[model samples]
Target: MRIQEFLQHHGIATNPFADEDAQTDLVFKTACIRSVYHPAWDKIYGDPSEPATAVVFGEKGSGKTAIRLQIARHLADHNADHPQQQVFVVPYDDLNPFLDRFRERFSARRRRRPDRVLSQWHLWDHIDAILALAVTQLVDRLLGVRDARHPAARDEPLDCTMLDGSQKRDVLLLAVCYDQSTADNRLKRWQQLRRKLGVSVWMSYWDIAVGVAVTAIVLAAIALLGGWNWLLTVWPYVAIAAGWLPCGWRLLKWTWKAWQIARCTRTLRQTIPFLRRMLMRFPAGQLEGQPLPVRAATDDRYAMLDKLQGVLRTLGFAGIVVLVDRVDEPYLVNGSTDLMRALIWPMLDNKLLKHPGLGVKLLLPSDLERLLDREDRDF
Candidate 1:
């Protein structure tokens, strides 16, 4: 009997043991692998009401990615059922962009201890990027639902009225700044925001140039007015003050607004220092301008992380879960133990791990398990 005739006899449509299985997505293929699928599901995706943070470690072909996908699917389904109280999943699995940025930062560390330099690279940029993406997605969806410009939006089952005008503007500004597709205009808008928030206390080049031109014109007018009256020399002194007037007026306006925001958001006994500084520096005042702050590259990463968490809590998300996997992929690691140690150590901070309204599912390679075991203290 031919091979086709033998399979037809057994009522099989195709070869059951074909290598084509390797080409499929692991999440679907692992559905039949009860031993691997069931345990992972029970630990990570079993109960929606019970909050959980877990670390799954396995070798390259051991179905780690499959579990991540399954957890996402489970959460998505849960979200679909309970739209009002949804659990947002922020996937921090893509490591390329962050790794590239991290490499740059690592190279720039000048003659410092490797561990100390690693500590400085405190994962704030990565955390900020994640939350920004989440906030953008949520705000955009809400706006699209309410916008009558789109015919399909009318059918979305969300109560757009839940967000007031100020909150809406705050969210919109965040979306614009976080959007990568936004061009040079993004940086310009960001600078405009810093001025409005009183964070950019210094005068920009454009402001200085405009003021200078105004002062020059004023000096010429005055000199011509007294053309042979011997007043041209004194006009230079007057023009000097006039040049600074435009810049001063703009600074005064910004200062007043910043003071208003700082006064309104101030409170007492804050746990998160980042939130404390942020609330003190730029509070949610008018919400007319961008709500996010632009930090220098050397600022504290922990503060950035805490500030982002506070922002999410303020936005009314009950829980935010960050899924992190593929630790071995970053070029910085390249199978080097020391490099991997530097990369993942800061993520183990006690405060970050124990933060409220946050859960991190870290799926690491089995090779890293050995490094994790060498820890001197309990985590």
Candidate 2:
């Protein structure tokens, strides 16, 4: 007898256990996602009004991904109902891009060793990756850039009018630092977002204009006061070069700052020149005293996350929910339990998991649960 006939004899409509992965399993996607519920469902999925963090560990084929999909589906339903107090869902399962960039940061010899590469991973790197993903998605919504892969992209686009001037600046700043779309022109997309948000970029070009104006004035002074022959002299050129001192100094400062950010944010695939160029597009006054993710500590990242949450709140998001799943699937980890432990241990910090206005759901492998006993009370 065929499997379908055997399942029918048991009074079952279809086979639910036939598929292993929930992402590609048609049966689970159509039926089980709505009806099936784990015993710990209520505990894992707390009140949507005020999100909470939950960490779950299970062996392979234990429905961890299914639970993640269910949470996403339920959150979508909740968002449709409660439009004002919606939770911003950030699916943080994809780790290959981050791991690839992180490995490039090390030497060839060091990159060969998975332990060494993963050992360098810290909570700040994770935070940077999350911020990059979140900011990129928001930019897509604002610009109406559609990607078939992103389910939420088909939904209503974000209302740009809802954001005020400061919030607009915050969104633009976040995009400059973290938007990582390889398909579109980064500068053009940023300019489009700036226009959509009604942000003024005139101030960003003030320094360059000042340098050019000063150079023009110097050349005109030499021609009018000392005759055209003075323009051919070395003194005129010297004065013209001196006129660019302000622009040159600002460029140097921003370049150094970009290098620091690129070096410190090891997981993000950004170069010094690109980051510097993006930084130059922002007005100096707008970026003054801003918390940039250019340090090794988590303090700056937390502050940036707070800024993001505040912006989201103004845009109708009551809170943020980060769903982290598939810890062992990245190429570097390759299903190795030891490397998975190294990659995930840094994110177990209570402070980050319990951060206000944020909910982090880490779906991990069962193997890592054994190492939890060795951790101290602080973890």
Candidate 3:
């Protein structure tokens, strides 16, 4: 007797337990995801209007991922019903890319030691990774860059015109700093996004213009006053070099800032030169007073989150829900309880989990729950 026949005989359409992973479970994805309820459903999927943090630790195959999928499905439905007050979902489950980049930051010996590599993981790294994921997805949707891998891409493209000038600047600034998509040309996509947002980046090239103008003036002056022979003089060369001072200075500043950001954001796979180029694409005025993840502390990340929330609010996302799961699945962790503890312990901070307009659901392995007893009251 085949499984389908057996299930049909029992009044069931399909085998609910056929697939062990919630992500691939057809029964759960199609039917049970909407109707089924875990006993702790309300706690994990809290009030979307006023999002709150919830931490759940379940053993392997205990439906943690199922709950995550359920929350996503429910949020999709909620957003469809209440278009104005939607919750932006950031899926932080895929950690391999991040872990790979993080490992590259360490020495070979340290990289071999998964425990030591994970020990270097901090809350700020998590924040950076989450921001990168969210910003990248938002950019994809806003620019209509469809990728089948991204669930949000299946929906209609976002209306970029909804954002006013300030809001557009916020989104572009966020994308400039945090959009980490390997598939697309970063600068090209950014330009597309800028055009979509109707934000002018003409001012961003002022340094180059200044350099060109100064050089042209010096050459024209030399040609008229001193003739072609003057071009061979050191004075003309000096004048030409001086012409590039503004552009060189600007490049140096952006390089230093990019180095700082790359150093601080360990989980992101960004080359300093690449980051500098991206920063150079933004107007100085737009980037001024903006919060970038250039510090090891969480303050800047929180500020950036606030900026992201503001942009999302204008796009009708009233709040943000961050789903963190599959900690033990990362190659660095590889199901090591100690490594998982090291990786996830930093994110348990109250300040981050309970931030205003943000709800972080940390679906962790039950093995790490034992370490909670060792934690102090503040944790």
Best by TM-score: 2
Clashing pairs in 2: none
lDDT of 3 by residue, 209-276 (tens): 88898889987887778688886779978877887887899899999999999899888877787789
Model 1 residue 164 lDDT score: 46
Residue 12's lDDT in candidate 3: 91
- Candidate 1: how large is its RMSD? 9.6
All candidates' lDDT scores?
0.53, 0.86, 0.85
lDDT of 1 by residue, 108-139 (tens): 55424444444455445455556555644454
> What is the alpha-carbon lDDT of model 2 when measured against the actual structure?
0.86
Error of 2 at 375 (Å): 2.2
lDDT of 3: 0.85
Residue 119 error for model 1, in Å?
Answer: 7.9
Candidate 1 residue pairs in backbone clash = none
Which residue pairs does candidate 3 place in steric collision? none
Which tens-of-lDDT digit does each residue in 212-289 have in candidate 2?
Answer: 998889868866787788766798787767777878988999999998988888888787887888888788777899
Clashes of each: 0, 0, 0
Ranking by TM-score: 2, 3, 1
Order the candidates by lDDT, highest first. 2, 3, 1
Off by over 4 Å in 1: 1-23, 26-36, 46-51, 105-120, 135-161, 164-231, 234-316, 335-338
User: What lDDT does candidate 1 reach at residue 126?
Assistant: 55
Task: Give model 2's TM-score versus the native structure.
Answer: 0.94
At residue 116, candidate 2 shows an lDDT of: 94
